[model samples]
Target: MTAKYLVTGASGKLGQSVLRHLTETYQVAPGDIIAGSRKPETLSEWVAKGIQTRVVDFDDAASMEKAFAEAGRVLIISTDALDRPGHRLIQHKAAIAAAEKAGVQHLLYTSMPEPANSPLLFAPDHEGTEAAIKASTIPAWTILRNNWYFENVFLSASSALASGHWYSAAAGGGIAHILRDDIGRAVAAALVAPTEGKTVYTLTGTKAYSHADIAALIGAAAGKKISVVEVPLEGLVQGMVGAGLPEPLARVFASVDTMIGVGGLAKVTADYKTLTGLEPQGFEAWVDSQAAAFNALVK
Candidate 1:
């Protein structure tokens, strides 16, 4: 192999997981990999392992171009720029420009679920980025439209589980949630594989279920009674605001809940399974595996 792999945002949780998987599971040589981050110093461990870490900021074109100079493939890990409007899309566009300049052969981007169809508050940025990638001159690209993560459950589960109460905007819709690692693995698969003809995929869990089902799983695993409560979309946003999220972030969660309620997050597919040749984990299985982590975080 002529050493082809450039992972942007490698310091991020998902990026780190993908890097670990590539090294451990795939046995990819560290020297063949390149990681990009604003603070490459943070990746001292990976660097010690022989992976090259470079300071590449999406906002800084020169750094990005230098980072991808010799990279044959690029993974534009979506920026967590939700806190600022249009910031993520602009950053993505910049990365695409760099990838093009670097003569990168492929691009694997992380995208949200059905951004084109969902009005889930912060979907416009993803939609806009998708459009830009489509319009770009890049030879090949893969859009991994990942669904909601099972981790979101823990954020709302512990509090309500102890109180025997739960709340959500998704009234009856079922969510096909996957772990963050799964998303990372999917991204890696897209990045390294010869997926020239494949441009898009909806990655999700093996199964999908509504909140009531989620409560049931959590309750069964924890040996406690947990109730699932539905809230009006507007009330859901209000509840989020009361929880200390900024008005915009609160509304974003509310709309996500609304999307859940309307099956926005239920678009499960066999793409992940097909890509990785392994069945995706189920919602309950994820919760069970996180028992220790959840217990430590509880109380």
Candidate 2:
């Protein structure tokens, strides 16, 4: 059978979720999907279900070319190579070049929101990848600019709940954070029913929430008062470093808050609904669903 859809990074959380949506939710045949990953053996479960698995490494041109050879639509999930500085861009460019050479019909990329001007540390990689995709000879392409994930709150929220204070530099800025599963569903929908020509979709929650607003939600969910302590970007970075985080990761955390403070993630878009025909989950609802996790932090 010809592979109609190919998803790179198929073993990762977002990739697995997208694959599940394609097979279970959209009723796409497993035989029509190609699940590609660096370690093809890790995808044995998918392979068991008749989903063809291939070893596709963004850094290896031959692997990427072979992976895209039979795919009509290819999804290039961004890699987590931020620690290596320019390596992520190099890998993404190789993937795009391979897809173009394979003559794929449509190419879809998972990108961060506002990469061109965002203050996020990894924005450059996404920006460069998007540029490369646009410059390539691929006949069609779609860019999915995903907002902050709701699950990312646990990176800082758990520690904050333990201390009863959430220190943040994002004072009044609101972020329209969406769930990862919602993003996965939207991505699967895009691949299943692709649009004509070049398209860019900024997927975000229907509602935006400020730091104070998130703290309030946490307070309600955990049944305890969680204070929002506003701090300067430098102070936030220093505090994170003092709390045992490495300098580079701490800087990334602080930069995210600084971006939030400048309303970088405040855009509320309807792209999710437009693509999946479902409303994205609200922040309050997501918080309530994770009440057990939040309450555990206080205990």
Candidate 3:
């Protein structure tokens, strides 16, 4: 009997993509995979395809244990419970405990690059989760340290297009932002083919792009010339807040520049190709593909 694979948070963007790649890209048997989501009903399509859909509430230990009990491999997608300090870590620890109690053979987790040394405010959550996973009794595990997503720039792209200015606090540092779907494809490959004990892969794009470089790419794609205006970190936060973002959320978003300015997310790696045997999407091409969307933002 082949081991069953369980993917937590299967209803999310990354999770859903992973499921698609597992069945489509890797041709994994749907019956051998379990899709775990807080609301499993959202995955009715998968359930109808002979896949097992189970509830995987991070806050509920008993349910999580039940979700993992039948799976030999488990992928724990990091939760987005950053609204409260320490809350995310608590949830991750519970998942680790549940996986151990359920006798899972291999555990995999989605983490950020260099979490322990990162300047991002949420780095601690990933760092703590990685530490907990390392301490768990699971026989084998894989840690994927994914870089920033290219889509993340869209958060400020609309406002930048509206004002014709891309403000930044990155201090000329660059970020190799990989596509979320590419990461999902790589993750699906990793989950299906278990690596040796305690392996880590840093999935990143081929090149790093500074704020100016990114602005140029977006400007060219949108047919609007956008200029980069370097500002202090505080100024960036204030601008975001002035743009109607909540102050707390603005600070959190602005921290990405803080992290970038320090070269925290500037590294490029080939690990993504190693996992999926294909190149991650390039920024220029990705921007070009989203050209219509960018044009709509300016209009």
Ranking by lDDT: 2, 3, 1
Worst 10 residues of 1 by lDDT: 290-299
Model 3, position 283, has a per-residue lDDT of 83
lDDT of each: 0.83, 0.91, 0.91
- Scored against the true structure, residue 89 in model 2 reaches a CA lDDT of 92
Kindly report which residue stretches of model 1 are placed more than 4 angstroms away from their true locations once superposed: 295-299
Put down candidate 1 lDDT per residue, 1-299, tens digits, no spaces. 24589898999999898998888867788999998899999999998999998888989999988888868888888898888877888998898888888887788888888898676877888898889888888888888898888888887786776677778778788889998888888777777786675478999998888888988877777767777787788887787788777988887777877788777888779999878888877777778887676555434
In candidate 1 the C-alpha lDDT for residue 189 amounts to 75
Question: Per-residue lDDT of 112-207 in model 2, one digit per residue for the tens?
Answer: 888887788878899999999999889899999999899998887887788889998887899999999999999999999847589999999988
lDDT of 3 by residue, 136-193 (tens): 8999999999898888889879888888998999999999999999999999999988
Which residue pairs collide, candidate 2? none
What CA RMSD would you report for each candidate?
Answer: 1.9, 1.2, 1.4
Clashing pairs in 1: 170-261
